[model samples]
Target: METHDSLLARIAPAPGQCSRTILDPATGTPVGEAPVHTVEDLEAAVAAAAAAQPAWAALGHDARSAALLKAADAVERSAEELARLLSREQGKPLNGPNARFEVGACAAWLRATATTPLDPETVVDDGETRAELHYRPIGVVGAIGPWNWPMMITTWQIAPALRMGNTVVVKPSEYTPLSVLALTAVINEELPEGLLTVISGGPDVGEALASHPAIGKVMFTGSTATGKAIIRSSADTVKRLTLELGGNDAGIVLPDADPKAIAQDLFWGAFINTGQTCAALKRLYVHDSLYDAVCEELAAVAAAMPMGNGLDENNVLGPLQNQQQYDILARLVDAARDAGARILLGGNPDPGQPGNFYPTTLVADIDNNNPLVTEEQFGPALPIIRYTTIDQAIAMANALDVGLGASVWSPDVSAAREVAARLQAGTVWINKHGAVDPRIPFGGAKQSGYGLEFGTEGLKALGQPQIINGWTATQTRATPN
Candidate 1:
């Protein structure tokens, strides 16, 4: 029953604590004040989670799953309030696959994680020997989330961790802490105290969390640089790490694809969340036969999508979440322009604009090695590169060090799948891009990240594995004889 203001007030910083005011990215106005917890606060939270984990784990899988189901219901009950807060704090629109979609995804992931079965597996069952593999809770898990898709990604980390019987301490990004705090507040209503906590702190707190001896695992989703830092910090403790790092995902359109038919999906795949997603298509490779037609159709789609204040229901696309991101996008686009890339739809923005509103830009006829193509421009701008053959497209897609996700678009599913297999990424789609399902396992390859997330494999990643090996009844009987 909480309204948007009531929800913000509920998670507001307590009196006398250091706090920072989060601003609406669309208007640069105040959204809410988030508590700035320190390293000491993070240590205390980890300690509390370690203390509370034993009893929570002892409740058994069924009991823990039932609790998660309740938490999912709690999320659904306050969906609207949470969506509004997320929209304002993250600068994603209220409709589309933005605010409301993110909130819904949270609830769906919770339910999926709660219900996905992960029973102990019998690895060996001969007459002379029997062995079963089981997963036990990893005392306390540290979840470091990104500003983009804050609530949904937070749930992606915590739901499976909690379901696997681990208590979680979350550290949201400095840019969007209010959304995470508000989300945790709603889920905590159905759980025991200290089982989950959010430490809205800076890098020092994150470093402490990664290195803290009490934490058994850390789930991080952010840039490659930060992921590498976490790896170094956790080396001493050897903490289990699941890192979904930066991705410059590429999409390949075969010669046979109907440009107009696939235009809308391609546009959203890149521009969703204003192109801030880690797995969104950043650079595209189109066969030379279809390049011009595809570019025209994509430009038409991007031009029609409204970009403005998130609060306005009519606007499906909003501003960049922060000034830093806007500046990065502007610089990359300018560089592309100077390099003689064709600006198909938009490449210009008014400097006088109040918010960080970079126009939905599509740079065509760009070189494969341009900064806009090679770098991760995590904004609403995509570069289209032309390829003469399938081998060239595959080579271009696999050239990057980071391979989180990729896609191959064609009318022939068989042909697309063949090309998809050649791409170097954790997951690849045929004719669609960035359509992640909770039931499927998602992760990164090479420098993108090491661990897998989602589905049963994801649940297993959050826990410790043990093999229960012993003699079978036949062996005991023979020994007695």
Candidate 2:
């Protein structure tokens, strides 16, 4: 594998920071490099953003909308190259970025942001006094993203901030910087320099950006451990926060469902990107009556799928992103097996292929005490815990602190809807898994993090609503226009 640092020379530049080489996750190769910002760099980026913000916001509806439409066009033009870079950096499998799902969604989102308004409207009216509400941009946003779903996550942060008329300075995880850098370049051609910036590096940079004075809001998506750190740093300014943290999401299979059908849904839910997704179904509770059948079908599917680097379109699973994830997966598998959980399919890393990746793992009879059942595994391992009733299943599923996403499997749409409604997750699917639409609001509840990130609610999350308690045409709107 070529040294990942090799790509440092040609990738792209951060608006006000130094750049670094970003490595490829597939083979530890360097596909390219990106700017790596420092505390000073973060501050500089924020300053630039603050200086440029008012003008961008002043551009208002039409001008901003036109620019964003240009961004959508750029995304469409570079879709293929972007997908290849996304797969190499993020370790998603065959369908990976090729799904074109997030790409198209972003184009639609950016355009939507361009047109949405935050102006004051008359709510209650009388002769001389009137009351109204006004929505305004919050200012410069410091957006920190995770390793999974780089392009989509970037849009989640940027579109809202831009749409609401605030500028953004983003920090992509150290693991997958190239993809973010590639994405920023596409946006750069459409907007001014400081409007959307990307910065890469580790802890120092993240803390630096989060706490910077010029940043008005800090939005983050990553592990719970790091999220705490970021929160602590942002305290000085009390910067507004939006966090989409880790999820040990659960999938419940009702007794009335067909095992084969549920098994298929759970496969993509659990093993997509080799299960590196934040909200990917990590813990599963199958109805006791269908336990054995569900296990059999899931194992057969896992064993049948091809695993390799994502460069080939035929591969269903790709290499894990790095050594740390590899070690974590191995430990989880071993621990589950030791706890007497039945390993029906892939349980360990493939030694024949020397890379940072694992196969789809399905374990049965895993107890709640097991961390694999309680914690967010964030890997390809799926521990199927059996339950007897809907109440028991729901109880077990809601038992974890991370409530990012969940799915209720049943051919019965009515039953699925009922179970899904009761789930304490940000997003829930019925009879289907890992299926997301651009129009639906996405994000998690509780420890998984607060704040919504898509659709209309998501667009609204980026806005500030001001109550016009006492108003005249001129005595009102003390707030800046």
Question: How many collisions per candidate?
Answer: 0, 2
Estimate, for each residue in 228-326, the C-alpha lDDT of model 1 and write its tens digit. 999999999999999999999999999999999999999999999999999999999999998999999999999999999998999999999999999
298 Cα displacement, candidate 2 (Å): 1.9
Query: Where does candidate 2 clash, by residue pair?
Result: 19-35, 320-357
Best of the candidates, TM-score: 1
| Top lDDT hit | 1
Off by over 4 Å in 1: 476-481
Q: Residues 1-481, candidate 2, lDDT per residue (tens digit)?
A: 2222323333666466565665555677776656666677667778889999999989875677788888988877776666666777776653643324445656767766665544567888875577887767888998998877777888878987887788999898887888777777778889987888776767898888888877878889988888888789999998888888988888898888888866766788888767878878888888888899999998988888887777678876777777888888788889989989888888866676656777678888889779778767777789988888899889888887778889988878897899999999988888766676556778888888888876666666776777777766655445776
Shift of residue 272 alpha carbon in model 2, Å: 2.1
Candidate 1 lowest-lDDT run of ten? 472-481
Question: TM-score per candidate, in order?
Answer: 0.98, 0.90
Give me the displacement of residue 35 in model 1, in angstroms.
0.6
lDDT of 2: 0.78
